[model samples]
Target chain A: MSTPLLSQGTPPVVRKKISDPLPVRILLIGLTLLFFIGFVFLPLGLVFAQAFQKGWDFYLEAIREPYTIEAVKLTLTTVAIVVPLNAFFGVTAAWAITKFSFPGKAALKTLLDLPFAVSPVIAGLIFVLLLGSRTPFGSWLGEQGIKIIFSTPGIIIATLFVTFPFVARELIPLMEAQGRDEEEAALTLGAKGWQIFGKITLPNIRWGLLYGMILCSARAIGEFGAVSVVSGHIRGQTNTIPLHVEILYSEYNFTASFAVASLLVFLALTTVIVKAVMENRFQKNSSQH
Target chain B: MGIELQNITKKFTDYTALDNISLNIASGELIALLGPSGCGKTTLLRIIAGLESADSGKIILEGKDTTNLPPREKNVGFVFQHYALFRRLNVYENVAFGLKVLPRSKRPSKSEIKDRVEHLLKLVQMEWALKRYPSQLSGGQRQRVALARALAVNPRVLLLDEPFSALDAKVRQELRRWLRKLHDEIHVTSIFVTHDQEEALELADRIVVINKGKIEQQGTPQEVYDHPANAFVYNFLGNVNVFHGRVHEGMVTLGGHSVDAPDELKNSAEKTSQTFVRPHEIGISKIRSEGNDLEGTIREIRLLGGQIGLNIECEGFDQPIDAEIPRELYLNLQLKKGDRVFVTFNKVKVFACDYEI
Candidate 1:
């Protein structure tokens, strides 16, 4: 009788208080894994597998091609230029919006979000219509012998427009949550405006700023539609990595295209790893309290 | 250093945050600006600190007209309620921030800064956590670090905005005593804002009670607590039972009892008034008393450690009358709920209905 009572009591006690039935849990988990493999992991794995199909030598040769190297350089340059500018703009914008009250604030906030709402293709087209030789300003610019459309500067501008909102969007909520207390404390401590910004505000938002810059860099590097529209597909000139891959794939250079695409995939993987490390560090720091 | 404000006024949009207000602070006085939330006590403090500028005012600090000076130039130390210690910096760096940010000509040397920071940390009794970040410390420890950071500048005036309000009751009490002792030793002219009357009474050398952007009264703790200026001050300072009645011929009648009014209300015209009596000022007895006694049945009894509270309900009264008695007296009476008792007012203040609370 005691053994029977123990078995009846143990079964109910061992069941989890908040969980679905076993079969339903299994089904949900299986569906998630299936979607991940089919949509994400499979394509990432295939890029590398196809790139190295011939051998390491062939893959290295494809990557060392002149156009591929130029594409890599152009992508890096765009990222280097875009990330710092965006970071600066993002910090100032977030600071101004969160810390001060002024007229036109709501309008300014909505204008900042315009890039996120407008299509990248439309953004590229708008720049073209404003700067192309057909318009008066464009004609004046052309008369001055500064060709903007269908050039490298146009490519940079288009990429800049497409990736404009990444850093600011990441920072606004973080800064707003932080409030103005520390800055005010610093001010009352006889610290000047620049000192308060450098010693207090900047340090407080460093992690958010880094995260924003990383995101901006990633988008700037991978931006294709806007850059393509402005690039004019000038081989060894305005062709970024993504545009280069398109050109290579269209010319039936599958191995070369895969090799070039692998570089982007590698950068993305590195970003994810860095993000994971930062998140772990952040959580550990918070939990230490 | 002593500080003086001359007719300070501030308005936000159409709402007046602070009306024309004037105050004077003697050197080495720890004054508490006591008020409810949104009473503009904080606005006045901020104006003095130069964190906010009053629309029309002159701020005089140490006999200098510093109304137009910025916060950094004002040389005031402000401790925020949330203990706004720099989160990324450890305790040492946070304490040294003010010193390090000084102008090149006045900045301390490296060794001097370290010594000062260490001394401040020890002064706050948080030297053990010098290397810990703000997130690593408890709320009480964070506040101590914040105090050290604020004091590092050695400003003429120190302003605290509800400094200990974020801590728990036990910690708050401990910190209050510690802060009082610290102020006595350092002798900085400090002003703190608080809505807690008990805190103001316990901590401040002088209490300034503010209401609706105006100064209600300013006095020593005992003076304000013993004699509130008006109905608002009396009601705000402590819990009191209000008895609506009529005053005529130097006597105020409440329910079935009439007591002689205070001298100030004696010669006035007959008018309806509300008599305020503190719970402890009412006497409770099992038998009827000789002078102005109202008989009622005990509706409830509460044990409050040292004192026993009885709620008495009498005829012609809409609310239960609260009476607090000593434990010994309550034990001698042997009263329980539904027992008949007599309650008499020992002290009362009468105010006409026209005065708003």
Candidate 2:
């Protein structure tokens, strides 16, 4: 089925559809777009309306307060740390998983994607098992003055666990399809391994990497379940923006909660915009190919 | 530089791709390792270039054994059939990649690298395409850029594996001639692997014929064409017409007709043999009670661009004899399917069929 445009001489471009019957295809697309608007855009509009009910005074006062400012700082800092480190880990893991032939390769790939399949709560528990003060390694590290649990590190670890596969998963199939031919060509041309990665492999995969990083940062910043389990939600000490929103909600401060949540909603929207831009760049590269 | 291989072999589990092959190539020579698919010609080229490690062999380049050396250590330029140009790099960057990667002390200066790359690009007549990415160039142009990039390294030897097999027929023919001219001008010891006999005959200084993971013959193109060492070489090199015959009473009996045998075979013992002659060498004419003639009926006729092929069925020969005649000569004959004709076998070479024919 296709959407046919009326024509005078030459027929207009007809958009193709996987289904039969033009009316049914149009109905299906209309329903999907309606669903997006109702479910996604409606709730977002509701949150924005709530944030501005008392005018810009409430929004500005909520954002300028020291605790709210600190929480925002902590969230941004966590994302900054998580994005680059995960990007590196992703590139390395993807390169190893795709290029080198070895035993246990399939098992390694499945393990790398474990966090994506497992619950965020269980991911948080994994860090607790390894780093909580109750365990021997944890207590020993605590004696050396390392405080992981109920601190910023704990939140970062939980975010890292849940967001581990984003960049690497994005890069593996891209690198695999691109093949090692260009890398081999560069190597033969006297480029070292790092030089090849920089000049050929990196540029080829930069768009996918950026998209993955944006998604990772979005999930890292907006994370609640995993970070909640690890952070202990101490006010003004280890509270992230999401935890701050939860704190305000528990105290029945609906306006403050919605205000902070709206801020994060804006951050997430920026992440989405970054993703859209990266995807557009990737599409241009693919069309050129 | 000269290349010599001794007892070179490569095996993959149950299949042996190359077996105990040895050859000596002179300096500044363009040798074509000509063979059918899976004949191990590319494997031999890779072994010599150090891209592949031979299971058992000694690769002596410039009088020094380099069998264990890696490709980078050997300083050999290799052009893959796919070209393998860096898609992200413009033509200039791709050409300068090798020089820029050398150690700081050994690396060429910026201007030197630029000049060398420019010079090589001009050599391949690709200077105008320098600012363009590989994706913007056509397949033939990309191959030319690949060749220029390879030459910029000033390799000790150049190895190309079916370099022109990816192009159209016309482009392939043009590139074949261009590569030959490039080789002559540069005077680099180069070895190329190809399955095209015409390219091998026209471009290579020496053609090494390989079949079934073994060398069938290695010689000048004329030597292999006019004096093939065996039946396989004769049939592989060109279209040959074969006839079963026996030496009896000091006379060669073919199709129940007698002809004088070559002098050396006159006094020899009677032996059964397979006599093979190229289609272009044998003469075909209409049967008019001609002297030393074998009667046959033309079964099929094919008109090629410059030549014509006739398939003739004769008694005592189950398979039809194929004759390739020039178009100019074809005009003088009224040969067609179902027409009776006499095929005159000229001085044909005979090989004994004692063990296997």
Candidate 3:
């Protein structure tokens, strides 16, 4: 065996095992768990405790009130309008940014993200400056009896402006990363613009679109600062769930306020669960791919 | 379908991806667009397929000017480099997508679509994978599905962009043979883009070698290989030993030694020249030659498959000359590294050098 072994070649070298220290790895794991428990789990537990402490009777009574019921209805209605609108805006903006090059593209990108950095309070004020009685367009609109300030419509406008960036921001980088070749490939295969969008582009970006929608819906429901400034507090009218909760808290009704807050918390938590499920589905899709 | 591109050019801001170029591709002829990366081969293919619009050009297909027509109206099929098969749809549905989405007047019946998909699946030998998604298939299987899907529409022409680049060597070889067989059976005018010279040589009826946004050469594989138009074409196609020299009065001087020029080059002007010879064409012998041989020392030797490649160090040459011979020849000569050998240049090509190193 030794006589002929030299003629062929030497066997490949076995690589050495380079591993992190076991103690350091354990410490890292411990630190990660500690941070999650302290920062994320504790507050979540507190919200759950407050939600169930009063039992179903108190919760039902609180939710059945006209003010509370109206608030819930208003919040859902706002979400119904905001989610689809933001989804459309987000996807269109992302497609425009990723696929097309035109004048003021960088400026358009900056403007798309401006609402995210600016506070919702400031967002409400910007609309006020444009649509309030102070501006010429506001006066013209007022003459035509088209009011866009200090009402439910104003609250929607503010929420829409503040939550504008969520969907597109999520999708632009994703669409870019997936690339433009697939779309072009679809087009070249006898697919028109709409067909390509429906078949190739939409299917590929569906998960990202859902992710953005969930995030935008969550943020839209929990919006307080923008809606508060624009919504003139009238019971069962301009008052949204968040603004109503603030009103109840001011009246020293801590339990009811926390209860309403917990309901909003519940909606936000549903969004989190949806995001988790969506992420898990995305993971499954990617792994199968 | 016959395709004509007249003065096609595409510019992405400052970078000119495709300079003004024109080409004609006859119907039922498979062509390979071979080039290195960023050579605008894919761009040209895309322009023909209508996936990308030419900045200024006329795309005439079968005597119809279709420069402004979109891809959906072009009636051409395209296969992407990544396959680009719909991951959500199974093989059958993916192939049937184009037919299903056709306009009411052009739409096929359900059974017709099914039959067409089945026929294409059988043609690509992928009938068993009708229910499998792209992710579920291997690279070779996915490429077959892509080919099947491209053929489902019964297109006038088929285009493939590096269809087998993502596969392993064994799968690539298998697919190459399968693709050629598929093309011959279908008799579709196809254009496949690749940077691999081996793939181009093995497949295309004619190879169009593109370089730096221009067609460097286009001809049959043997014609391009045996008689390259320039140094770039020769070096890009395959491995060859290039010896820089000077030609004067029907004589070529290489490595301070004179060699008689071939009769074809008898009327050559007195000019600096470069000699092109394949490594396999050169032979090393134990018997020393007189005027036909150069004395050199073997610097290194490599046993590659059935051939032995030798780097010979000769006088007046900075770079070692490389020669490849069969293992039996090396065994007969008892050649090893550091052994002195006589290298002979039997047949060589001479070209006037435009620039010198």
Candidate 4:
């Protein structure tokens, strides 16, 4: 409601507006839109369009192929194994770094960021060098009849390396900011270490953990370079969705390649939607505090 | 329970947080560890609570050695400065957390826990917030819940770390009174750390002044306030005006006036000394009543609710001298800025210049 005295007694004062001029504002917005369309939206749209160029029957047939089905299963299995292991590692690493003081703390922090800094292909190669059948440890493992490189385990390891920092990076700052106050309070109240972590620390960082898991799973599903190096292109056995797409494309199977690529695009879109929802919930929860 | 610390010391890298110190706190006594930031007051409280370990010391609680006990085994309730309530749990669950975390054999039944939580919440006057999360509550309310949660385990001693510092001025005052009342009702051996001298004075039965990892003094609030042990304690407890003067026989000459020095300094050799006087200990007059009174012009006048504070500029003193008098007395004197007035020291404390703060 307007104040009657101010409305009747005086004219509104002119205030200096803080904004860019019209043309500059329009130009910046126009450039951002053009970049998004060219670099992001168009490629995503082209995947689905090209996948369905022939017909629904052809698209369905390509998706139903044995190799394609096996690729989907392998991808799901990789995510299923990688995400939980990484999540466990993330929570433990975050808890150790944030809650305790130890020698080489700075070095440990730098090592955590190693996954993000090193190339995924190089990570795959490092594992190969250490675990390949030619090395002493690899030959020892070979004597034990356990194959790691160029197998499902190798694919899992590569994905684990690349997505290692997600959950930990998300939770380190969150837990650090939350501090050890609550845990100390719990301990003073006669709660054990696990009780404090389960009843206090876990719940406090739940949203952040979920957010990191989602990002990890998304990367695990669509990982290309590292998984490619380790999988050995063993058709239905070792080929994941991205690797399968590459194989199909290089073999001149255009329709099948696009169809498989479209699935990844769909998965990426779903991840984006879930991430947006999680972000909204996280903001709401944090703002309430 | 009673707490005793023998030769407690703590260090962080090169900085010593708590020097070798010893103290005894009687059961059911409300003690305030008062100090400036980084003076090791919080460290002492944490050590007693078993949240921190002294480098070499023995902690005796209720006549039992508890130096190596973990916080869980120490049976001390701690309320953090920020409240530290579980962000995800509602008030009821937060209060029930301690009891719920007890061993299965020792834990109370469901109905018993519910009754206890409800009673504790009511004790803190937060029963109506049973279903509300900590995020929905005010700072004072969160602190109340934190206290309730701490009390759920029925600890023998309660430790509060700057409990009221996070709240606003009005809320801090209100909660200070509330905490005092609660301590009276429960009669638990409670120790709270605070940097606010007024809070310490108003809430603690006894105040222990700490500075640079050493105990300066410990006494009842009135005793410490009236008779400080040293220069640091004198300057910390309240605002005071300092007079740089010399003690030559039994009298100390300050500006143009001379007053009898303290007995300890009076018998010492002739040397430079510093005289300390609280704001309310100085008197102002329109005319020089005593032959030893010093004259100065009022440089600033500040009305402090029930009292009037005047900053007087004397000829020899580099800094203006502060004097506070009753509002009624100010009205009678009709004092204002630029008025020339005579000032007299009502009560003075003398310390040798070598004892620097």
Candidate 5:
């Protein structure tokens, strides 16, 4: 047998990346980093800097204000209530869309996404028009001793409208990707509807649900335009955190406004971090589970 | 008693997936629904398992009408093609899912459930990977766990939908053998769907061939293979050489050659008929023998492992006839392409021209 000596015959070859050339890759990466720095980091850093500009005492005083605490409580309450409601709605909607084939399914999916495309202000207007005191349904509800407008319910409703699609939209594609075969298997194994859902469906969609919940919470907490529309700006009564922050800024209390804004920034940052951690777990769970 | 599907018809919009399909499965018999893709074999199995609703029919299990019953009430173990093990659950948990899902009044105790799951896992020979999640396991392992999961319920009948079709070829063969052995030990009436003729022929005690929402034939594997009911069954069961010819003078003529027709075809109204013969049934000779049926020249010789395949081109035949010869015979003959040979068909199935494959 003759030895080929292939290594000696061939010259060293330089591997070239066709997907992205060196200059283009570097330029694209640099531009992305610069965009995040200038828009995200700068704004976030400025909020904290300006909040503490008046020193720790002023920042503490602003946070300790009774109205500030009220707004914080209201935002938390809205998130606590809205997140679960929307999550439930999202799960049922996603389940219906993925599990069954029915007429008008596509239309139902489209309608679920309507709130997403509508401006936050328009969402608030839609709710207000349907539920306000001047409307028949609103008056009927008022006759039943319910207050929807200029109240916590109204603010919560607006926030819910704005954040509703986050959970369902994220979950639908995930549920669809994870087909109904497992559920069918469970059912044929003598599993009831609830058992199949809890044992098979819920475990498969937990990470997606949690991711959607965090995002929904963040959106609900940070909702400004819609809440501002229906809140009526009642200082400690109807004002959510975002509306309260606007009130503080308009009153020239920049430090107080930024201090309130800094809370939202922390929440957004935490959401991103949680999403990053959850994303890795999500992929791992989906692949290995 | 086993299962009896009475006129089970299912339609998806205008497309009839199962057109009044009726079947009788014997107790403790392992059967297979064999057909090509979209041939309603899977639909038949799903209908029997209560995973799919039939438009109009009766599903009788153990002599009781189970029509319109939901899957939860069916008491049947269904293994899907994709395995469909709970992705989040470990192998042990997945196998135990059926036992756990049983009503609390009827559910086995925890220790009993554990013992059952372990026994089933061992039955499928997947006990070593009990703690591994489905995604962490290979396709073959997942299917084993899926089988164990289905058996966990101890249902009267077991239904599998192309249980090993998703696996690679080698794994699919191994699993088919494993499934046959498992069915033997359990003695549970089992029905599985498959498009592979070998899998159905090897694993099934009875083969039900479905086509276009109807049962084409149902009998022992050998029965369907040796004497296929129609052109579809003849072609779908295995490789067969189709000879399209005319019926004249009590014989079917191919090119310039002729063979005696079947008893029923005497003076048949049909002007044309197709004669089907298996590859191995055709005898090859270097010269024209006394009972030779056709004169042909070898177009191609293929080495098919222990058997040698020859594609013989004959006059007036659109496609070359495939003849399989034993390796020993092929070696002794030293046959090559373009060799003149006479073929003697030992057995032939004659069908109407309209039923040509």
Candidate 6:
């Protein structure tokens, strides 16, 4: 942190009596590059390589298939439902935790980060145990003619559990750093509580909120394990793009699976670019303070 | 009618922030709550502004009991220490925010708000920065905008918590003058809290000195400075030398010298007292003469800008006594380090013996 790297554009090279050897720095950089290319870059390149292996007409036919199109719609709908709910939960959680004091504050904060630590599969299983038809509430839901487990609602709920922490985690630190003085100033100026949040707090945290929402949306779209366990693979009803990819690959339809995966690849690249821009602005804003 | 506080006390678990305190501010009078850090001055200001609520107390504003009212209904303007200008809003919007947030029935039209905001910006001399955000302005300019924004609602009272302390020394001085002129024009009963004695003395019509969660004294600047109520008031207002002594028959005996003590000390239950004497009040002579109750060697002579500071090491005191002399008087005396000099007090402040403890 004392190095200029974190706060500003330029990172200074400090030369003391002892320093890292030239070979060691090069070795560190080279190893990271090798690992990235081997595990990450090559797989991504193969997705595009195989997507076009058949030709443009075949690629278009694969994506335009009814099941694939249905999967795309389901994924977009899931993201639309999950993202806003997650965002509302994130903003409220951040506001409550950062803006006030309560007895169980420490415990609540630790629980907010639980989703990040819990495995995606385990997160899906928690909801299954709570709401699946085998349990009493789940059985009651069934007797009431409601189908929660192995349905769209069940998949959406499981996805919610896994992608819950992104927006709140991003907002908590940012809002906490920008303390309550400005809000108090607004109150003195006769602004109502909601007005203060809408005008003052929102503008301050807009970029960070956007960053978290993007990450949350991306996580909701590409999630495979949790949605798989909960969805029950009801084709054309609950199969998301990631689950559809699994189905196509399992059937040995290599061109279609890679074609679907290339969409994910493009989404991932956009996410990386957006994350970089948001992270840059966050750093600059923090430093300016 | 103005503002009144009755037995306002605040305790933070174990430490008391404000002891049972009561004060009243007259209408249209500008006062200052002046003290060192953590002396409960800012706390008192916040409680008055309704940002803080005092436990078991009443805040009467213009003959209305408003202790439980929120800041929005309290109708008091607070300018924070570090000008809390909304970073996202431009100067014009920041100033118009108060007017626009008013209830629709009481709110003015768009053109009226525009004219008022423009007028306020012109009043604060920040018209050129109307289109600029707070981040783009310097500390002084942001503070000016904060002042303009605070005054936009035309509240009955204005409270500033160390308004100029965040700026640099030169800018702070300039802003003090600017604020005084502004207060004169608007005359909205204002109370500012500051720790700097000079700022309190120069800007405030009445200065309230607080320490250890209690009001030590409150009066006009001249009254507090010239006739301090007690030893704490004397020392807190300015630099002074304290001589520990005992009083007998209207005289105080200390450090091989006896001086006329205040008349209250003669018949007081406590025989011991301390004499407070300002450095400038105690004149210095090159040679021993009549009325020279103390003598010391000039340990150091420092020219501090327009004035000369002399540090004298005298017997019976472990620390050097600091004295200031005008540059003109210093040059005439041609004083030097290691020079022997005798000191005499022109006036002395006497207080009960427990003051030192």
lDDT values for all models: 0.87, 0.85, 0.84, 0.91, 0.87, 0.87
Expressed as tens digits, the lDDT of each residue in B1-357 for candidate 6 is: 688989999987778889998989998889999899999999999998888888778889888998999999888888999888888889999999999989999999999999999999888888878898887777788888898999999887899999988877777787788889888988988999999999999999999999988999999999999989888889888888897878877788766678877776776654778778887786777777885458889999987888788999888665777788888878887899998888777778888776434
Clashing pairs in 5: A289-B87
Ten residues in sequence with the least summed lDDT for candidate 3 chain B: B260-269
lDDT of 1 by residue, B1-357 (tens): 488989999998868888888889999999999999999999999999998999998999878888999999898889898988888788999999999999999999999999999999888888878888887677778888898998999988889999888887777887888889889999999999999999999999999999988999999999999999888889889778988888889998887678887888899778888889999999988777685678999999999879998899988787889889999999998898999888888888888776434
Q: What fraction of correct interface contacts does each candidate retain?
A: 0.70, 0.39, 0.52, 0.72, 0.75, 0.58
* Residue ranges of candidate 3 with Cα displaced over 4 Å: A1-59, B262-269, B355-357
- Model 3, position A86, has a per-residue lDDT of 93
lDDT of 4 by residue, A1-289 (tens): 1111111112349999899999999999999999999999998889888899998999999999999999999999999999999999999999999999899977897799998898888988888888889999999999999998889999999999999999999999988988998888888888888888889999889999999999999999999988888889999999999999999999998988999899999999999999999999987876666
lDDT of 6 by residue, A1-289 (tens): 1211111122348877776899998999999999999999998889999999999888889899999999999999999999999999999999999988899998999999898898888888887899999999999999999998899999999989999999999999988888888899999999999999999999888888989999998899999888888899988998999999999999999999999888888877888898999899877775653
Q: Which stretches of candidate 4 lie over 4 Å from their true place?
A: A1-21, B355-357
TM-score of chain B of each: 0.96, 0.93, 0.94, 0.97, 0.96, 0.95
- Ranking of all predicted structures according to DockQ, beginning with the best and ending with the worst: 4, 5, 6, 1, 3, 2
Candidate 2 versus truth, CA RMSD in Å, comes to 6.6
Per TM-score, what order, best first? 4, 5, 1, 6, 3, 2
lDDT of 5 by residue, B201-309 (tens): 9999999999999999999999999888999999998888888898887888876778888888887865788889999998998876685557889999898889999
Model 3, span A169-262: residue lDDT tens: 9898887877786676566666678987888788888998999999999999999888887787888988889988999889987667777888
**Residue-wise C-alpha lDDT for candidate 2, range A136-190, written one tens digit per residue:** 9899989999999889999999998899999999999898988876776665566
lDDT string for model 2 (B122-223, tens) is 778788788999878776788889989888888878889899888877677767777888898999889999998888899999999999889999999999
For A121-213, candidate 5 gives per-residue lDDT tens digits of 998888889999999999999999998988999998898889989999989999999888899888888888998888889988999999999
Model 6 interface RMSD over true interface Cα atoms: 8.7
Residue A190 lDDT in model 2?
A: 62
Query: Would you estimate the TM-scores of all the predictions?
Result: 0.94, 0.87, 0.92, 0.95, 0.94, 0.93
Instruction: Go through the candidates in order and give the C-alpha RMSD of each one to the true structure.
Output: 6.9, 6.6, 5.2, 5.2, 5.7, 5.0
Instruction: Report the candidate with higher lDDT, 4 versus 5.
Output: 4
TM-score of 5: 0.94
Q: Which has the higher DockQ value, candidate number 2 or candidate number 6?
A: 6
The TM-score of chain B in candidate 6 is 0.95
How many backbone clashes does every candidate have?
A: 0, 1, 1, 0, 1, 0
